[model samples]
Target chain A: MVSTARITRQEAEDFLYEEARLLDERDFFPWLDLFTEDAIYWIPIEEHSDPTRATSILWDDAQLRALRVHQLAHERNFAQSPPSRTVHSVTNVQVSPGDADNEAKVRCNLVVYEVRSGDHRQLGLGDLRALPAKCLYVLRYEERWRIAHKKVVLINRHMPLINLSFLI
Target chain B: MATQQATTQRGYAELVEITDKTFRVSSRVYREQEVFEREIAEIFEKTWVYVGHDSEIAQPGDYKTAQIGRYPIILTRDKDGAVYALLNVCRHRANAICRENYGNSQNFRCPYHAWTYRNSGELIGVPDGGRYPEGFSTRGLSLIRVAKVDSYRGLIFASLSADVPELDEHLSPVKEHVDLWADRSIGGEHKVLHPHRYAYLGNWKFQCENGVDGYHPGIVHESAFSTFGEFGIGNFAARDLVKRGSISRGFPGGHSTLEGGARDGRGVGRGLPHRAEEYQARLREVYGDDRAQEIVSNRHTFIFPNVFLFDELVRIIQPIALEYTEVYSHPFWLHGVPDDFNTRRLYEGTRQLSTTGMVNPSDLEMFAANQTGLHARMEWLVLDRGMQREEVAPNGERMGNYSDEVPQRSLYRHWAQVMARTEAGR
Candidate 1:
């Protein structure tokens, strides 16, 4: 059985910062380890969507998440020919108790600034785009905190976007 | 020949060169602002452009907004269930009357002057009407209606010029294929769900060429297929695509298709492994086994100028400029199918085609590269792949190997023909 301990706001904030760091530093392999087996990394088109029924920007299970990471890291994946460099800013962490004793729900505002890393300063590839999002995370503790679900709703989710190949 | 003479007179004849042995398109076709402007004037404005599906505005007052070239259009189902395409601009001050993407409104009141118009584009109420002159009349001031509007199998199309051929003439070559796509639903109706809207930095024609060009999938989407292979998610034998009988076809009016070969009995439906049996069973009950099997075979149908009907979704391409285009991919639900079936197809469609999906981003990346590369001094790009092996079917359609540029050749041929014609029929 998992421990029924209350997760503090600071602890949840710290956990989010580490996850954000892993993504920003492009350490996707280790970032993949932070999720539970059944965890979902979802970026929904609408604020609330039935992932099974409705379309999303992304809805990845453990298997798909791994595939995405592999594809990003692959040499021939020219979409990331000069892989995107991103800086994730996570703020306003508000943690609350979840329905399960081992779970806690945390909400925060996030801004991710992404740009191409190399000399390819083409229009779509070079622009420093900012993705502002309202994010929600459900953290569960077994031995340590693991993400059960992470939902990201971009401020401009409904608008048309460019290549979002990098992790957001 | 007459159209070519007219285009030559206008000094635009050198863009595309065609001979018995070779077919070539100028790089300027992808790089020039003048050529882009002429395309909007000569091709998009004169051809039948897809607007929205009939299912989108099924009820009275239901409406959706769209674009044909540079013109903004509103497609509406009026009180009598008649569908019409009207310019979205207000007749009075040139302000747009309807600003929302979609809604059910019997009347649209212009925000600038509160000039209200009925769903059918009749000027119903002009606020403070007494201030106008006595000779003024609203009769000629209704929103400008598109010259031609028609549909085939619930896919609506509008043309700015009535001088164009009837919609059937444009769609005849691909009507049977369209039947197969629409008949996936037992009732022959499909619902367009919300779309995954995205844009790329490339010429619009690049997308038009890419959709039907089957050759690029092996190289462009190698990463996606490899990832899928690693997970054992689907049987993505990209190498066996040709031996499996996949084929590319080009019709006369620029429409094209990439059809799955017969060797893959499950066809592209392999994407949704769990729902295939039940879905095929339901299809067989409605259509006989042969027809059901044909319907099950994967086909990506590109209907000339704007839209693609493929794999349980409709992808629309909108051109913004010489090197800017927007795409909308809407995964659709078939009528008379189980929710699970629709849901699974939806997931598969969005998984590979959405803005952030593994497959399409690679294509978009290539589009950006192609746009950047077109600036080089190279004069021509080759479209001669499979020219020797391509065959003309009894139906007058051209067929070639799965990796052939037959579809691209057909697109440019038709584009050249359309670009040569004058609106005045000179």
Candidate 2:
């Protein structure tokens, strides 16, 4: 149903890679810009959850997104202080048609490595948190491709989750 | 194991050092496996520990897994709606029976030997009953229920030992807080959302202490509070008030509460952020203004051993090892509140308390850091904050300012008594 020609897998990969790079570098504001005004970024504790009915690890509308972005940008955000370092390895980018004429659906695998360390030595923490996940993005082309909805499903969603202080 | 335990018991004096006005807990209490085992037997096994909310297993045949101390059990409701807690282990071959988190089933059949049990935990079917010797007897083969199960306003609690104190007696200190909270549930009750489970790479006691710990927020969670300040909604006397106008009470049996004293309905940790005029009006009409206001006041409570109810959150601490703990947080959705209000509660609950919670990461980090620091050969972990000003209320309850160590000392006092308990000198 996409109005434009079928989106190439490489282009879809580019969208995901850029997003990952921004998150890895803690470039949250620009990363947040990739989302459409009403876009949803969700990480369901249970797969295929209804965000309105069920709880999720991360369920952010644009307003909630702005709040989170503001928190991450705030100089006093200690969780981000000394900041968590993350490296996301994305693979198997796949693209399919979206529900709307301007939309593109993309799915990929993500393995994120995170470490919370530095200057906190007084109380003491150089903790490591790592996990793998599947990310599905519902993209819309408004001038350029922007995220309409994104869901990240962790492989170990059932495991007792540690601090997910960094972006997936 | 017994001899090594004897050696550890001898060090119990060194494990905890207490005075009328000061207390110091050794790092070993957080690091020793023997101490952990003793606590399982002396504290958790002997005391009444909270299991699940009654609403969680409301329907017949509804079941979910729960833990007592370290024993895994299944909390199931039978036909005709009798609630029961059965050990998850199977009778035959000692295998686990129920594997799923929760589901509706009148019977659970063990995959190991196909031993099936009715929802009431009766041994209804055997793979081949005739194959057994005549009258071998399946008399005591039903799933073992916890020793005693009681509830305080739908908050189900179970004691593993028959000698444990009555539920009301154990909850005496915080009974008023519990009853007030339970009554405030919009329709006189609330439902539990699926728990968000997480683990802290620290001892379980840290959670019991930290839930009502008023001293650490300004310093440890400064980043989170400051982050909230950037939003303009958080600077309104939250952290400042936490250090003042507040009183914490220590209960018998290692339980305690931190109660903030503002009765103006503007308290930060009390209720939903929305004006909630309709909700409050209904509450005022039902319970009257004085009672409703008292109920709405926030009470951060530790229900001994491992359960905490703070605001709308119910956190159950599961001790897995000396330095590892798994926690399950059940955010209650009030029955009478608007769906939108419940939705926001769920959203912000995740934001504030879940695995990736804003306020919790720093707290968890501090706990882990403390555990890491305990590796050093330190003599004691200082917990003497505000000991001088601790007051004994007229009712004989131990009281202190919000930012005092009185509650922690209260807990350690109970812990000390439990660790030293012996049935009439053995």
Best by the TM-score measure: 1
For candidate 2, lDDT tens digit of each residue in B24-128? 987778877788988888777777888899878889989988888878888998889888888888888878898888889999899988988887788878977
Q: What is the TM-score (0 to 1) of candidate 2?
A: 0.93
* All candidates: DockQ: 0.77, 0.53
Docking class of predicted structure 2: medium
Q: Supply the TM-score of chain A against the true chain A for every candidate structure.
A: 0.95, 0.91
Candidate 1 wrongly placed segments (more than 4 Å): A1-4, B1-13, B263-274, B423-426
Off by more than 4 A, model 2: A1-6, A73-82, A117-129, B1-14, B235-238, B264-275, B423-426
User: Could you tell me the lDDT of residue A162 within candidate 2?
Assistant: 78
**Model 2: lDDT of residue B386:** 79
Report residue B82 deviation for candidate 2 (angstroms). Answer: 0.6
**Structural similarity to truth (TM-score) of each candidate:** 0.95, 0.93
> What is the number of backbone collisions in each predicted candidate, taken in the order shown?
1, 0
Count backbone overlaps in model 1.
1
